[model samples]
Every structure is written in C-alpha cells, then in structure tokens.
Target chain A: MAKTITQEFTKGLWDEIPPFRLVLGLCPVLAVTKSVENGLGMGVAVVFVLVCSNMLVSLLRNIIPSKVRIACFIVIIATFVIVVELLMQAYAYPLFLKLGIFIPLIVVNCVVLGRAEAFAYKNGPVRSIVDGFGIGIGFTISLTALGALREVFGSGTFFGMSVFGPSFQPFTFMVEAPGAFVCLGLMLSLMNLAGNK
Target chain B: MVDNNMVDTNKFIVSHAPFWHDGSKISTRNYNIALAALPAILLGIIFYGMPAVGVISLSISSAIIWEFVFRRVTKRSNTIGDGSAAIIGMLFGMLLPATAPWWLVILGTFVAVVIGKQIYGGIGANPFNPVVVAIAILMISWKDLFDFNEALMNYDFDFAMVYPLAALKHFGVSAVDSFNAGDLLMGKQSGGIGSTFGLGLIAGGIYLIIRGIIRWEIALSFLAGVFITALIFNMTDSARYAGPVIHLFAGYTLIGAFFLATEDSSSPVNFIPMLIYGVGAGFLTVLIRNIGVYVDGVIFAILIMNLTSPLLDKIKPKAIGKAA
Candidate 1:
C-alpha cells in the first residue's frame, strides 16, 4: 500500500506487461496480430477502453455492491468497447474490417476485466487512469512487436512496404495460426529472459 | 516387475539386478541408426548426383550448427556429441527433394533442430519426430515445392513414369500399369532423395531391426497395416485403388513405415501400443492417399499417430494384485 503512483504505473510497462508478462488478453494478441498495423490499431483501441473503464470503475467502486461488481464492470467496459468500434468504423474502415469482431470482443478481454477487478476497484480514479494507460500501452507494445516479427518473416512486408525486396519469398507459415503461437512462445521466453536480468 | 534373472550379467560382481545396459551409449545408438540409413542415402546420391550430396551434407551440417548454437545460447549442456542432430539432419535431408534450395534446407533444419527438437527439451523429449515436424510445416507452407513431379521435371525422365501417387490420385488405377514393381523397388522411381529406393529402405530397416536399435513390431506391423488395408481396398474395388505392392513402394510409404514411425520417445514403448501405433499410421497413410486431398499421406498419418501414442501408452496391462 505504501507504493508510489509511479510504481503502479510503471509496473504495467515491464514488471506486469500484458500478453508477455501478465499474460492477459491473449485473445486479441493471438487473433489480430498478423501485421504491425493491426497490432497497433488493436492496441490503441484497448488503451481507450481500458482508461475509460478504469476511471469509471474506480469512481463507482465504493457505490457498486460487491455481489454485483462483475456485472457493473461489464457494463462499464461494454460501453467503451462500443465507442471504440464505432469510432474505428468512421475513421479507420480498413483496419476495422481487418480487426472485425475482435473490436467488439474487447469487452470480454481479461486484461480490461482483470485490471477493473484487481486494480481500479482498490485505487483512486487518478491512479486507475494512469494504470490503464500504462497497461494499455504495454499491451500495444507487445502486440506490435509480435506482429512486426510475424509480418517481416510471414509476408516479407512491414506496414504494406516490402522489407525483404521482390525476390524474398515470404515464410507463409509465420502468418498462419500456428506461427502466431510459435512467435508468442518465443517472444514470451525472450521477455522472461530479459525480466530475469 | 519380478524379472531380474534375464539381465545380461558380466563376469564381475554386479550390484543391480533388473537393469540392462548393453554397453551401448546414446551416441552409439545414433551412429547405428545413421549407419543403417546409409544404403538409401548412397543410392539417392548415385541417382541424383551432386545436388543430392549437397542437400544431404548441408542439412546435416546446418542441423548440427543449429543445435549447438541453441544450446550455447540457452547455456544448456552440450548435447551435439550424442549424434542425434546428425541423425535428424540426415533423415530430413533424405526426405527432401534433391533439388531443394539452399535457404529451404537451412530454414528446415532450423525448424527441425530448434522448434522441433530443442524447444521440446531436446532429443528424446520431443512429442513428434523432428524430421516429421519440419516436413509437415514446410509442406503446409510451400505445397508447390513438395510436388515431386513438378519440382523434378527438368531431370532426364520419362513423362510416362509420372509421380506414382499423383498419377494414381488424379488418373485412378488405370495409371498403375505404367509403373513396374521391380523398377519401383530398385530406385528407378521419382520421389524424395532417399525415399524412392524401396530395396535400400528394406535393407536399412532390416539392419535397424537386427541391431535391436528399433523394435521390429512397429516397422513390420506398419507395413502389414499398409499391405492389408491396400489389399482390402484392392479386392473390394480394384478399379479405384492401386494394389498393395504399389502402396508399399510408392511415395513415402516405405520410409514412413521403417524410419519415421519408429522414432524413439514419440512412438509407443510397450508391445501392444507399438503395434497399434504402427498399424494406425499405416492405415491412415493409405486412407489419405486414396481419398484425402494430399497425394501422399505418410507424413501426416505418422504425425497423427504420434499424437495418439501417449494415450495409446495408457493401454498397458494392469498391475498384478491391483484393483482393475
């Protein structure tokens, strides 16, 4: 309880980075990370949802009955997800099409729900907002890193630009479903290695 | 559990009763398996010439290098001395087309050594054969590269002698007459570098069995499964299915039966489980070849059976005096 607000914020970046460290919200991590753009887009959307939900949840934490806390949390998270989905449709139609049902499914994302129950419900709104941004940015970084690795090898491209040139044959397997798991595993181990030091 | 007298005791005073070490090391077993595979490899090199030798050597060397680098990076104890990487490399090379490109060979070995073997805790801990894993992934990624007929078309060959499996799959049983059983057995067929020569595979398989390096039950029962299934289909509708002999000689059938299916650790250990694994792989191989979308089913079939081997191991006999 004596921990500073900065410590709470910084923990999400490395000490408890989602997907790689905390290992939460893997549904979006594995599903939408076929390319770097998709990863970034998905990451930014989650950031919006997480920050809003966290601030709202922290403010209502004292009012909502403990028995109905989960139901209340879902309602808060679902509203933010709808805002994200509609905003994506208006501003980024192509990316929205690429991410599809995954944007709506963010309501069920464990990382958002986990932070709501574990962090926001216990902390002040200011700290909760900071925690959401920190964790949301961490999720974005992990997703982008995974997507970059897969895109470079799997498609021989980076953000639609060819990195390996014309002659390079894409390792098609890296873009497929199994490649996502393999990439996720390798990156997880690497994160653990860095964390160990 | 009470069997201890069967241990081959030396003249010296022995402390252990039930333990049996045939004075064989892991390296020795690896070397023996490598030696057994030599006849087929040599035949492949003779037929395909320099390209064949290049693929074999590159795959073997790269496989070793990958294992050594991975171990060094992870700071695990050096296991390259055991010769398992060499065996994996050799088997993978033999399975590839002689014309396989340089990058594909390097990448395939990386997949085999790193993803397939070391990632699963190295050597005996892998759930599926390393060679099979690489092949299956490569097969999924690059279907065109594996099409033998297309890949090897430039070589001096008769078009009439089409890839036996593709021919049968596309043209039906009428294409069977174009193939000679004797030619297929003697390495006159078109296929993977070492997989074409049926006689050499049989020789290598027999060597492995005789050395007691691999259990004969798995290999023979696998062949039996292929033969029986193919035979049953041949009798029921000869027009639709090729005969049992072609099923045994063509594509990856013989190699899958003898080498790939018999990989240690991934395969069942007990007697009954071994039989079931072998037969199941063989049955699926034929089933896939006849009806499935793929031209040859040996690798996929063996991989599927490898998945089932752990569950099949549970089918062992109950302990004496224990409740059922």
Candidate 2:
C-alpha cells in the first residue's frame, strides 16, 4: 500500500507531467511563460491549487453527488484560485502584475480540474495530495526550462540579469513567439528523445 | 482542363506516383493558396515602392532556381511545376523589407527553397513550414536587417545603400520615433515589402478563407493569442510594451499568421491540434516581442508548431476500449 502511494506521488513529476507529458495546463504554459520568474510563480500557484483541491476532493469523494461532482469540484478550485490571486496582489505585486489575467484564468486550467475528476475523487486524501505535488512540480520544471531558454537566447538575460558580455548582441527573435516555438520544440524533442531511453 | 502538353502523361503519373502511392495527397486548395497571395504581391508594389518590386521578383525567381537545383542535386523528379515553390518565393519576397538588398532577398529564397522546403525530401516531407524556417534563419544570422524600425529610418524612401538596423542600433530609440503606427498602417513606413499594407494582408487573408484555401481557426487563434498576451502586458505596464492592437496590426503578423503559418503541410489536420498550434504560436509571438530580442515571432511560432504536428495528432479523442 505504501509502495502504491509512493508511485502516485512520484508519477506526475516525470512519468505523467501535466504539461510536457499529458499536455494539460497549456494556457499558462504559453501565456505567463515569457521569463523564468513568471513560470516559477505560476508553477507554485498551480501546485497550491492542485494540492488543496486534490486533498479536499479526496476527503469528500463519497459525499459529492456524481451528477454534479464536476460542478462541486470547480467551486472548490475557484475558491483556491481567488485566494492565490489575493496573496499575489498583496505580497508578490510585481509577479502579480506580470502574471496579470493568467492568475484569474487558472480557474480553468485543465490540470487542476483533470486531477480533481480523474485522480482526486477516486483516491484517498493522502494519495491525492501526493499526486498533486508530483504533477505540479513536473509542470514547474518544464515551464522554467522553456522560460529560461527563451529569456537567455532572445534577450541575452536570465531572470533579468544580463549574462552576455558587453559586445554580445541579442538574437531578439529568441524572446518573440517564433523563438518560443523553436526553443519549446527543441526542448520537447530533446525531452521525448531522453524519455525514449 | 488536364493538358497533355503540360507533361508527358506517363512522366506526370510516375513522378507524382510517390506522393499518391505513399498516401500523401495534394489538394486543389494549394493552388488557391497561390491565388490568395495575389493581393499581397500587388501591395508589395505599392509599399516600399519599386525596390519592393525588385525583391519580390528576385525571391520568386530564386526560389524557382533553387527548387530546380535542389531536385537535381537530390536526383528527385522536379516538382516546381505544382506552383508551390513559386508561392513560397512570392510569400518570402513579400515578407522581406522593400529596402533589402537583392542578394539578401536571393539568399532568403535559397534558404526557403533549398534548406527549408526541399532539404527534407521536398514539399510535404518537411517537418516545419519552409517560409518560417527561412525567415528564422535570416532573423538570427542577419539580425540587423530584420529590424523594421531601423530599416525605415535608414531608407526613408531612398533604397540606395540602406542598411536599416544599423541606423536604429546606432542612433538609439530616437531613430524609431520617425515611423509611427499611422505610417506603418498606410505603407509609408519602412517594413517588409508587402506586409507594410496591413489592410491588404488582412483582405487577402479573408479572401483565402472565403475561397477555402485556408481555415479560420489557426489564423484567429494566432491573432487571439498575441492579442490576449499583449493586452495583459500592456495593461500592466503600458509605457513599456505596445498595446494588443498595435501588436496585432504591426509588422508582417497578419500575413505570416494567415498565409504562411496556416500552410497545410506544416499545420495539424485535426481541429483541436490546429487550435492549440495557433494559440501556441500567438503566445510565443507575444512573449518573444516583449522579452525577446526580435520584433517578429510569427515564423518561429509556426515552425515550432509544425515540428509538433505529429505529436499533437497523436492525442486523438479517446477510442472506446481497444485493449487493456
């Protein structure tokens, strides 16, 4: 039983990543992913929502009306999202501004809702919490990877710090939409190739 | 309508047999794509004036030449007659700055035709869109040349010895002030030969959709992604980044999103994947412009999506129980 719980907890980190593997939570993955800072912030918010919602849903699995379970799950998810929004505005003001509409938009992130329906409602609270943590970490890692790559190449910076020497000229396209695709494509391909091994 | 004079019927069948036999089909809509590019061609002549005309012609001609050379080198049957290479060349030329040197335009065509389109066994065989691939290469290698603001400042209606980015880079942000949004819309500003007439590209894109040469989802999603992302950024700090409308209307985005990125071979065939592809491209374009080094992101977004086409296709609606 303990071994099974460990498997669920670790699965989302790589074996079932919300973004790179399952391809969920793409809006934020593409939207707030211009820099590593934004990616890290969103990633944390996702983990918060995922863990809270998953744990709550798992605790109430037997009680939720099957027909309206989805509706009930959404309400729970939305409550967490609102809390996250308030926290970001109050504390992480700069990041809140950077993330902008995306923080509110997290209410619709397929990853949170997906776990609520697929894993949380079926499993116990402890297992669901583990699953949420794993998936959220996986998402954060992928988004950070793509964000760092685009920031460094496109702008010659990393987390707003210029890494390129004085004479270094930036490949401006790297920060643009085209660069996002190129970097993500190469990363996805590399990820896929590595996973194949 | 099927002219025997166009080809020895046997050679046409044999040469095209691989595409047909391999179950990769070509559609008449591809020809309509050529038709869609007509307005862009006319607009190229209007903006950046005669110099734009030279770049357009050079791109189309060089694309044809390179297609022939690539086919000959690979010992494959010549497929340039299908008008696809010509379309790519015309689009490539249209995307280039009117003030660009002839050699640069020719080089861009070579990349689009040979390295981009033909290198992966020609046409449908390539993973990424050829035009986007060529534009990306040029944007990276000749970073200075792709700067619209710089090009506009240096050329100032004089095409001679104009290297636009040099002026912008040297004079700083002050040089960019001369080319405002109004001039950019009206085609008076220095920009890619045909894309300067933002209205013309939009009009042409609409025509292609009406003619069924292209679908609206990919184009709309791309525009939507750029608009939404830019809007959020602009709302937060309007002083730094341009608003969503400016990001949408500026540069070659309309042309690139509608005509170039929506190419059948490079985009996913299914609606869902295509929607994801468009949104992804749009998101990337905005991210790049705001934080990236380049002002354009359409080509890069399209190429990246093209690379992911196969994987996106794999995520089909769940089949009802095939196996355990």
Among the numbered candidates, top TM-score falls to 1
Q: Report fnat for all candidates as fractions from 0 to 1.
A: 0.54, 0.15
State the lDDT of candidate 1 residue by residue for B122-204, as single tens digits: 76668899999999999888888888888878788543535799889989999777787888998777889989989989998
Which run of 10 residues does model 2 chain B get worst, by summed lDDT?
B15-24
* lDDT, residue B167, model 2: 31
Model 2 DockQ vs. reference: 0.08
Residue B219 lDDT in model 1? 95
List candidate 1 stretches off by more than 4 Å.
B1-23, B157-161
lDDT tens readout by residue for model 2, A22-54: 988888887777888988999999999999999
TM-scores for chain A, candidates in order? 0.98, 0.95
Q: Considering every candidate listed, which one attains the maximal DockQ? A: 1
Model 2 regions more than 4 Å off = A1-197, B1-30, B154-185, B319-324
